[model samples]
Target: MQPDDVRRTDVSTSPPDVKRPTRRRALVAAAVAAAVLLPAGAAVGYAYTGEVPRGVTVLGVDLGGLDRAAAGEALRAELARRSADLAAPVTVRVEDRTARVDPSAVGLAVDVDATVAAAADARPGVFARLFGSPTVDPVVAVDQGRLDAALRAAVGDVGQPVVAPAITYDGTTPRPVYPESGRVLDPATAAGALRAGWPDAREVTVPLLDVHPATTTADVDRLLAELARPAVSGPVTVTTDRGDLPVPPAAIAKSLVFAADDSGRIEPRVDEKALRSALGTGLREVEVAPKDATVVLDGGKPKVVPGTDGQRLDTAALGRDLLAVLPRTADRRVAGTLTAARPAMTDEQAAALGIRERVSTFTTNFTGGLSAPRSNNIVTIARDVDGTIVQPGETFSLNGHTGERSYAQGYKDAPVIMDGKLVPGVGGGTSQFTTTLFNATYYAGLEDVEHKPHSYWFSRYPPVIESTIFYPNLDFKFRNDTPYGVLIDTSWTSDSITVSIWSTKIYDSVKTEWGPRRNITKPRVVHLEPGPSCIATNGIDGFTQDAWRIFRKDGKELKREKFSWRYDAEPRFVCGG
Candidate 1:
């Protein structure tokens, strides 16, 4: 390409807006395109096959007097050496934080073939080869979009995100979550800085931009005063059809929540479900209760109460009503409208349970140690569960009802079996009470949720069917699977304890058929010297047995289930101490 001489145009003759292109500038732009766009290996191959003018240098390597093959070989060796250096990670820095990212991972490459073709573009005439030395630009390939993403990950999220203002209710008090300013590293600028430093720079410091949150401290303070503080200032009265449902400040606090709007201003929202849960048993007094169809013991006879739907305060609209009155300082009251409510147990479901008679009655007589502390413990736990009511489909838990029996609760230490030996334990002999209750529930054909028999066989209780309980750990539980409500009644004397279960009888009777004992193992005899802890015992042999339960309704077999258990051999306690 021919060069154009520089000539300054006269301002008087030419228009200011009109600018002309130079011939030398155009040729230089075309030469750059030839070098940069040498994207094909065939072009590199063709360039290497050609003789280069002397005084040419690529990356400070003189190809000045080299042949076609020699020039290509030298260029490849130099590029390979640079590639090894590029294998090290490119260090990135943002303030004090520094990270090392792999060159290939960030889509950076030497592009050897393209660079080789580009280096072949440097040419000099005979006179210039003797006097002038020129340098060829290396083609460093970079994927801009990929580099931006890689740099963003290498530098941590630029900085922290802005914390928006919000409010939360902590019991009866209102609390505020304040907003804060943060910093951000612009992706495009960071990527440019990284590219300029990579494979050559020791480290690059990324520029940071300060950011401010949409919500300010003033906004949070305004919300706390206007909405949060007043919401839980005092109790709110909601008038129902029957009486007033008083919602305390604690409940009001639970219902109040804060959220940000489109303009980032904090706003209040009432949660109806949360409000109902916070209200708890208070709703039962003011709201008209729905009567479920159930059988109850009336005048010592089974009686059915027909199901009836009742009208209660409309919980769906309670939030709206509460929201209107929450911010008021005086007379924070709202009139709640009534809505129809349905019973969980309908009349048809109660009738199907067949709980119209005394289902099961059990009596167990306690001998030996009748006047001991064990008897007192038994009576104490028994009285706690007396007249207990088990609703339909409800699982009655003995441990849950009577709670942990301790000396504070009037329980005394007594001899109890633990680790195959008789040891003194609190709330002892309650296992007898457990056995009695288990028998009653078993005869009633109730659903037994959990039960565990004794480690050793005892003549006092039935085999493979008795239950033992230890305060909080071991428990006897039974579910009233029938629709009829179960009434647990207990009575205890000095020598006898009796448990009777009353419910509408679904089955005429539930009977257990015994199975012959097998795999009998004799007990090991051991003697303890005379001491206060010494207790004598005549241990029974261990055995495995299976018993079948026969359920009969209207004198016909309804269903049959099998029960299996393995009893460990009880050690003979020959106390000589």
Candidate 2:
């Protein structure tokens, strides 16, 4: 009935770690217990008294005798109270921005009943039974409500459902966000985060492309409308390749649309205005069809070669048209010019020609001296018959283009030019033809790309004056000087071998006049053993000459250039003494 008795019982039953109650409260509680206990036996009295059971107290509130329902109700109220107490918006900082959200946003709930239930599991033991009344055990369930509140407070606002805004990534360089599940966040994820972080966000339509062949803007608009509703409660249809795809309205509304940009980049977004605008534009019509363009090879309609019946040149035309299409002068347009230019040769001419009608040529193998005291222009004229043209970017191969020299190709055995002396030979006197072509190219201002010098001296071909042709190794090559293609024209007579270069020229006139051989330097002497058959000729010694050419335009000299030539004397020997 007294404080001393209450103290004796409490001390015996109280947990060692638990602090004793305040003296005033302890005394009053003891008195109340005695008043009720004196009438009934101590056990019955305490049971009926409904006094504060021995257990842990939370904020001075005892919750010992309550049943499960009552305890649960009480716990719920406490959780609600705690939630309200912490209702003040929590300010969370991420990056450079701060966000505010209520603690309840993170799902915090409190249950006093659970704590009581746990406490009931921890009943007073033998010590309490021996010395004092049995004490109620106190257990605490994790304050899920409070914990959630704190977590939400820390996390800021997360709008919609727990899994509301899902992120879709275009697989581009998207901003990074870490998901709780340790996955990478895509654009859709970023959108979801934005929704969770921002409250004033309005509904926006995200335009998405259909994977199917056909889809209408109205269908997409309807889907958007359904998503824009207050709370998406049911499934909705979204267009797909297979057919309409039924998806949650909430998912659709907050869903990010993936659309390809001009660069084929998938962009995830949810802009209703932009979405509607895009859908209105409709699908892009197929642009250019796949087909082969006609290009003429050589000129005229390319003749189907004997072996190439079903095949034709890849291009529409060749020669002039080809030259026009190739990289050309600054002012000329390749495509336009090629379309307008006519084929270089007629169809009949091409069919008659062995190779197409562009140019026919053959090489000469001359073994004797040019202008051999016995050899003359007749042999030279007869050997000259082939012609050629230098297309842009083409390299001139004298022997390859001219072809081999043989009896089968109309070549006859005659005096030919070789190392300075005349002799009975085949394909002789071809140098005149080569020299003539060389002069033409030189006068035409074309590039003298490759040329071989004669092995012996020649009055006709002073150094820088002659071009030699050998079956494969020796050659004379020149590039066309004008933007317009150059055509080689060859004609032969008993007295002359003429090789003319015909092409369009920008220059009104190209004239060549020899400049005085100036800066005369002494020639270097050369000595060598002579062969037994070699004949020593008088007055033949090594000489050096630097000659100048004055190129004239109309009448006036436009440029003056020098050409250097070095000659070594031939050694003489007696064949028969």
Candidate 3:
């Protein structure tokens, strides 16, 4: 044979799989070159030249043999749904409970650019590209810790709380309440499931496990058989020093009660008030009334008044006897006793408290300026503050004593400070009463806990020392710093309201000193249309000032405290907009 014929025979004997791929590529290259040369085949040549490697796919959408731009467009179009779903928050369910979680908050995201680039990078040999189908997993970023936290929050309270055993009275009979089981969710497993399923799904349901309570049905059964059943079985005769008292089954049911602790153990407690009430008028005849000592204002000074003590049934002794005799089916007789009872406030305790004289008094004159509604609000607040007694070491809260002053609470519409102008608002003109009370507390040498000065200076109030109050937010509070009890006495007329603090005088007198103003700023004028909502104001200049409180004893200064404030300018508002 010739050399050329021998070489051709050798090539033909090679494997068909390897030989076929090489031949096919050569033929395609020849066809591409031919198509480029021909005038009408240029478009087809352009299409085949820039195509990606065959058999490449991303997320199940086929992108094999397509150009780079087309591949990217198709990839983005197919993944648009998952991308949007990833941005939206997902809801997680566990039994009846459900909560929402944001994928971004949990550090979960789909990397589209990276995924497309990866698909572009796939370049295999011709045979493999033709015969094999390759899949590119999309790029997904996940933070394990953040994902766990989000899933944990989303699965909050996934289980029901265990119910403990208890007992209740059914009119004259005792009934038992059995314990119940519950379920709990597994957060770690839920997070793992979400990481795999999210973006593809908007809702995930986690599995739950059973949980048991500390107290069981057996405990309820034991309690019912041992204590509850026999206690209300028969009548119990209670004997006081005077005579015998009858407690029937219904009364015993009212008196007996059981409480369960955290450890699920039942403890019996006596309702002394309920037992006395259930005794049915027999106890009233045997018991005597006791009086409490009180302080009264006689003439102009406060005086300690004496009180009396009386005889009453011993509650502790009665409880012990009743509990012992309850379990017996026969001879249910309990012996109780009458003992001497003391008043809540003894004469010695009342005498120890020093409330003898008028320590300080302040009166704000509203004589000519206040309207009828304002006067009514002032008098109403004054009546609420009257007869109030402040014990030693107690903090008095003005807001706590008087709740939100609304129309339903008997306050009327009047002028109030708002936006640097006087507007008609409900519960207006109450600030005058607040300022009066503040001055009274100040002169009494009490500790000011909290107080806010007016935004602009008012000529009617003492500069830098008075206060303004609004409901819920702004409040006037003071601590009674003295060892003596304080008696707050308020009196009002049509024109003025006076608040007086009465106690044994510790300081001779308290006085205030003003400081010169600084940082003065001029006010601006503004005009608005005249309407019911419009409020006109004569603007005041802004300034910073200080005040000093001087405490005196025996005509000499004891101590002094400094208070400072900064005021804002009140703009001149012309109601003609």
TM-score of structure candidate 2: 0.32
lDDT of candidate 1 over 1-577, digit per residue (tens): 1232223345545655554546567889999888867755444444344466566776677775566567768877886887768777777788777777777777776555666666566665534555677666556666767766776766656576666678887777777888877666766666667655554565777777666767788888887887788888888888877888888988888877786654456667777888889899998887668878766667777666788998777876888877787777788989888888889879887666656667898887786545788898888888888867687889999889877889999888998887778878888889999999999999999988988999888988889989898767788999999877787878877798999898778888899999999999999888887676777788889999988888998879999888889999888889873
TM per model?
A: 0.53, 0.32, 0.52
Candidate with the greatest lDDT versus the true structure = 3
Error of 3 at 429 (Å): 2.1
Stronger candidate by TM-score (1 vs 2): 1
Order of candidate numbers by TM-score, starting with the best: 1, 3, 2
Q: Candidate 3: misplaced stretches above 4 Å?
A: 1-164, 168-292, 306-343, 367-371, 528-530
Least accurate 10 contiguous residues by lDDT in model 1? 1-10
lDDT rank, highest first? 3, 1, 2
Tens-place lDDT per residue, model 2, 406-474, is 555545555544465434455555555666677766666666687766644566554555666756567
Note each model's CA RMSD in angstroms.
15.4, 31.0, 21.1
